[model samples]
Target: MAEDVQINWGKVKNIFESVTERMGQNPDRPAIGAPKAKVRVIKERLFEAKAEGHTFQIDEPVERGGNGLAPSPMAYFTAGAAACLTSHITQSAGFLETHYTSLEVEATVLWDNRRKFSIADLAQASLGIIYNIHMESDEPEDKLIALLKHAEDGCYASDVVRNETPLRAHLIVNGDEMYVHKNGAEIPDVPAGPTFGDNPTGMSKDEIAAKKRDGG
Candidate 1:
């Protein structure tokens, strides 16, 4: 029944109208600020970060002289990009009044540590972090593509990953460089098997099925 329910078209229209009118009249009134995070070193290769009352731990692996207690900082960075992109995709869907039975985003990082000889190489060696974003949604192909494009265009995390922001290394915070590298030879040309019934682009068989079963 939930999947069968239609989006509130009237509310969607009103929201668009109100947003446009407000932006046109007072463009400078709604100034959004970037989020900030503060971290304190707990011990060797371990730290605690606080952001908006939420606290989390960051640590390196046991092989890296850490206790292997919490996820490494790189894991958090990968997750943040995925989370931000998902948020943007959902926001775009809502703005367009699109309905879906389920939506999911997965991010994978390809890290090359060949040049990781010392801390000094962090800024240059770690520059080869590549992200693979895979999303699954039970929406039409056109709408889903549009949503993904909108998210990619506006997602702050993606922008940061794309190196669109300025960076500086300080004693307080370390500077890192990351760039996405695409190699056609390493990528598959097509899906290995038949497309999933729910997600045409990419999704496992266990993923959510389309609300309305359409021809695949």
Candidate 2:
């Protein structure tokens, strides 16, 4: 069993208040952060990733051509969003001087695998996401509701989901730039990868068992 963890709300409140005061004085100051991740393929459906001096592995399930040794990418994606919102809510509660015994956040993402497997293109890969927050506290309902609203508005992950973000892809092959893709626009005279024709064949059960035995 895990031990109970305690938080110093006084310190949290002081830090938040000091940051707010400084930001208020320099309203136009720009604060920016660029978080980067480097991923390398370990096998057919297994990968290793490094970010912020931390390393982790990502693997698909047996049906997705992997040994199922680690959490899938989608799991990380959903958890990241949930964790971001939870952090914001905790900080907001501290700044508001609200007391809570426990807080929990759950996130779910609806997905359609047909498009991913080339079975159909009628639906998107990710349909939508739902978030539920539960808190045990003696604070008034209205005050808690207000704090939730403020935290939701300030959550970076929520903002990313609610807004449209542009993505640019640069393809490199054999140490040369092949093409740059932006907004699904075609690049003239650029070679394209093979089209999806059939579903991928995953690892066999015997292979998965052997991988597990080897502590993969």
Candidate 3:
């Protein structure tokens, strides 16, 4: 049998209560955070991204003109939304002192790619996302439903998809400001940087092993 997952309800409840109390004292208090990611293209349809001290690679499938070395950007986006909802559900359950044997969340993203490839002008690229929650618990059905509702309301990723969020895009070419979508203006181009060389051939197995052995 698999070991049961454990959570400290007392700690969870205390955290929620403390945050609520703080917010109640200052209703207009702003809690803003900006997470940043630096991405660089490695080759066609392949990129490396560094965020929060972690680095990861993103690539498209072989059919999409990539080497199929990693998951695509859409995969990460879908996973982020699903994971956010699952996190909220788990945290809310702990806060409410609800018990559960297992919890699983499955997500499906319906998308149209006609506009992406400039083949046709579509109404929207993302049709919708469906999330299915499979949870095993002895709790009352009403309680479970309430928990789901709370999680849906609190999930930021779900809100982003459901609401119209303004996006400001800017393009910088070779360290020169090229365009700003917010103002719908193109800036005068400056001297361009040095042209890029051929794509790098990564280390071989022997070199990688030697580096590992040398603690590099």
Best by TM-score: 3
**Cα RMSD (Å) per model?**
15.6, 13.7, 11.5
RMSD of model 1, in Å? 15.6
Task: Name the lDDT value of residue 26 in candidate 3.
Answer: 58
Q: Give per-residue lDDT, candidate 3, residue 208.
A: 66
Over the stretch 1-216, how does candidate 1's per-residue lDDT look in tens digits? 223434454554464555556556756543243456998899999999999669999999999889999999988988887788867666666777664545556677665475575535444444433445454447788887786787678788777666645444334225644544553234323334442211322333444355224422
Deviation (Å) of 78 in candidate 2: 0.8
lDDT of 3 by residue, 1-216 (tens): 234657666766675666666556757744333456898999989999999679999999999889999999989889989999988888788777775778778888998889789898886799999998888889998899888988899888899899776566779899998986763345343234321111012345698689779865
Each prediction's Cα lDDT score?
Answer: 0.63, 0.76, 0.76
Candidate 3 runs further than 4 Å off:
1-3, 183-216
List TM-score per model, in order.
0.61, 0.76, 0.78
Looking at model 1, residue 179 earns an lDDT score of: 48
lDDT of 2 by residue, 143-199 (tens): 999989988998888887776655578899999999977864443432233211110
Weakest lDDT window of 10 consecutive positions for candidate 2: 193-202
Instruction: Give stretches of model 1 more than 4 Å off.
Output: 1-23, 28-32, 118-138, 169-216
| Residue clash pairs of candidate 3 | none
Compare candidates 1 and 2 on TM-score and give the better one.
Answer: 2
Instruction: Evaluate model 3: give its lDDT.
Output: 0.76
